[model samples]
Target: MMVRSLIDIFSAKAFEIDPLHFQDDDIHMKQALVLKQVKHVLHKLISEDPLESLYMVDIIQRLGIEHHFEEEIEAALQKQHTYLTDFSSNHKLYEVALPFRLLRQRGHYVRAEVFDCLKCNQREFTEKYGEDVKGLLALYEATQLGVEGEDSLAVAGYLSYKLLHAWLTRHKEHHQAMYVANTLQHPLHHGLSRFNDRSIFLSDFKIKNEWKCLEELAEINSCIVRFMNQNEIIQVYEWWKDLGLAKEGEFGRYEPLKWYMWPMACFTDPSFSNQRIELTKSISLVYIIDDIFDVYSTLDQLTLFTHAIRRWELVGTEQLPDFMRTCATAVYDITEDFASKIHQKHGLNPIHTLKKSWVRLLNAFLEEAHWLNSGELPKAQEYLNNGIVSTGVHVVLIHAFFLLADTVTKETIAILDDIPDIIHSVAKILRLSDDLEGAKSKDQNGLDGSYLDCYMNEHQQVSAEDAQSHAAQLISNEWKRLNLQILTPNPFSSSFLIFASMLQEWYL
Candidate 1:
């Protein structure tokens, strides 16, 4: 599907779609002042209804303009947390779940047991609240945050999924049905882009005069992001053309624009243009390296390549194939340049740390390469234990932390070194999503074996359909772990959480 999607993107003519146009710069400048007033009016309006305040925060975030009013949103959530705690028993499912999700997403320490208040009534929830699709959707969204041993949420999530599916099937053409389907496809943290593409959210918020400003602001911000991203992508294409990496190998799957979308999704703010460019270049290199290991490289060549990465020096470049040499050189130069940027800006030398991440990434690749050659099928957990690292989440997080941090300290490095629960959870989700979707594909021979294959091999009685379902469940559970970890006290900057969430969108 990725290959087909890329082909469609590249094969299409530019003139097939209409170009986006906006007013002159002077007109946009005038609207900037209006935008400020709209933000103020929005803040004041949300301040009146605490529940609506939290809901609007969620909407603003989905609209991709939360950065404009971060302080105001933060203050509102903090106060809402206090108020919600005092009157905890008085709210409905939508009331409690909305604030809970918003707070935890912003790095607050809301407990999983907060949903304990709803556990005893789960059996009657659907029968009594079946018509409350909004509340059920909110409950379903909140359940995405379930951690280990949160039985209440596990049960609630199962019910919510079924109920929502039934509702969608019955009201297939309704707007609410469309919203539920979109939520199931991409949950809140990852669904912002798709949500913004539709007009429902805008119309829902346009009922009040003050919120009209917010709706307009979202439209303006979305346009800015679209324009900025298109220009940056053209620049990246020029850079990729100069490198000639795509022409050197037998592969035609090298898609720079597709790779750019991941980092662009992560850092949409105009301030991090450099980070987006740098991350895109590096991740594209990762895509190349992954293909080499999975398809092109022999076991002997992989060993040499892995050793070369571990050495982190150009001692054995001569032993590699022409393409591998090109890849290795690019990795070393790009990462070292990244480290240099950190050193120059923050006065901290991160060369070793950055290299360490690359070494670990390559080692994980080699581990899987070796496993594939041995004709031995490891258990699902064993493959996943190493497969998560191979997903490149850890390496990406390392770079993101250094690239976006205001200050780099020893404590921050230590926190990054620990492979916190958040990274693990993301890695798990990526691994499962990969296996689940890959199993459905007909082109399986040349690809690396997936977790679905491992599960099927281990349990001969389990059908492929069952195994796929199992993998889907694993992805959902890992999401819970990922959600829980973001709320824990941590040294990571909030930007890392946003990056992790963006990764969920990418891999899913």
Candidate 2:
């Protein structure tokens, strides 16, 4: 069976934006003025009581405007971290959980022991706290940030999930129920802030006089940001159209806007426009190359294509098939172009590193092709290990590091070269998620079998449902590992680390 095109699966109209909104000059001026007012308000709020600061910062982040005040948010969080020493039993679960989540998310260490005083036993929080739906929601959000061995957080997560579900059922019409429902589906920590529905918070804040300015700013900024992003998408879409690969090869998918959404979500700030565009180009190549390997090429043709990519040049392409040559040439040229831009701007040459990452990815794809041809099932662990690299996240991220990092030290390069735990964790999450989705879909038959198949093959008598459940548990374990990586010290910049987490969240 042929794989379905994303264009057939997703409605293009859903991604369309109105040109009239982009043409309005009045809105742009209002946005600037309102942005100034919002920054002033944020600075003042950060200087207020710690609890107020935490609440405001949370609001700012949820509104997707936190990038505008990173320094202020950092200072506020640092101050709040210092204030944690003075935290008392008088604080409600909501107060405690909010700070715990905000601080830990920003990489400020906070012990899970802070919840010990509120717990009635090792296994659960006090039953009385369950009545506080707002507190339960906060605890549920905080629990998402928990690392491995934080048994209390794990228990709190389960209890909060159950209690929140119960509360939502009873108060189905309550305004807060909307939040509970959304949080249950996509926890705040695991969600991409850029894609959050700001209108929900705006509606809630409209009732509060103190939050009027914030509401206004969030509203305007969201509109302006949407306009900016839509324009960028238009530009990328135009580039994709002109590339004519989808037209010429007639094999790969055509979804530049969809591909562009990944980097745009990862790097939300407007200044990263070039990085987003270039990364989208690279991503387009990934899909085209993937199609060549998975859907179109014969074994001999794939082996030759792999060899050409390993050679990393156009001189030897005469021996290759037409579609493979087109794909290979595009890959080589785009990679060279990215290296040139990096050299011009950052005065660094990562051409070799960039090319090597792609080679590794292609080799993994070829390995899978080899397995499918041989009709041999790989061990679950072996499949997962290769699938992590085959996910192509490393290539995307390695390209991102050069484009996004402020400084590229030998240590950081070494960490990246080693395929650090952070990258491995994220890659595994994406691979497993893709496999799970593939397991659910019938159209993915052309690909190598998934982890679910491998797991069941290895462990006989495990039902399909049981294998899926185990895959989900593996995904959850990866999330914990990723959370731990984000919180701990690493050679990566904070921007890169956050991007890694956001990318995984976007995939999930």
- The clash numbers for all candidates, in the given order, read 0, 0
Q: Which candidate gets the maximum TM-score versus the true structure?
A: 2
Candidate 1: segments with Cα more than 4 A from true spot: 1-23, 88-90, 112-114, 120-123, 190-196, 203-207, 244-253, 442-448
Best by lDDT: 2
When superposed on Cα atoms, how far off is each prediction in RMSD?
3.3, 3.3
> Which whole-number lDDT from 0 to 100 does residue 81 have in model 1?
74
Clash pairs, model 1 backbone: none
lDDT of 2 at 102: 92
lDDT of 1 by residue, 65-99 (tens): 78887887887887777765653555777888788
Error of 1 at 137 (Å): 1.4
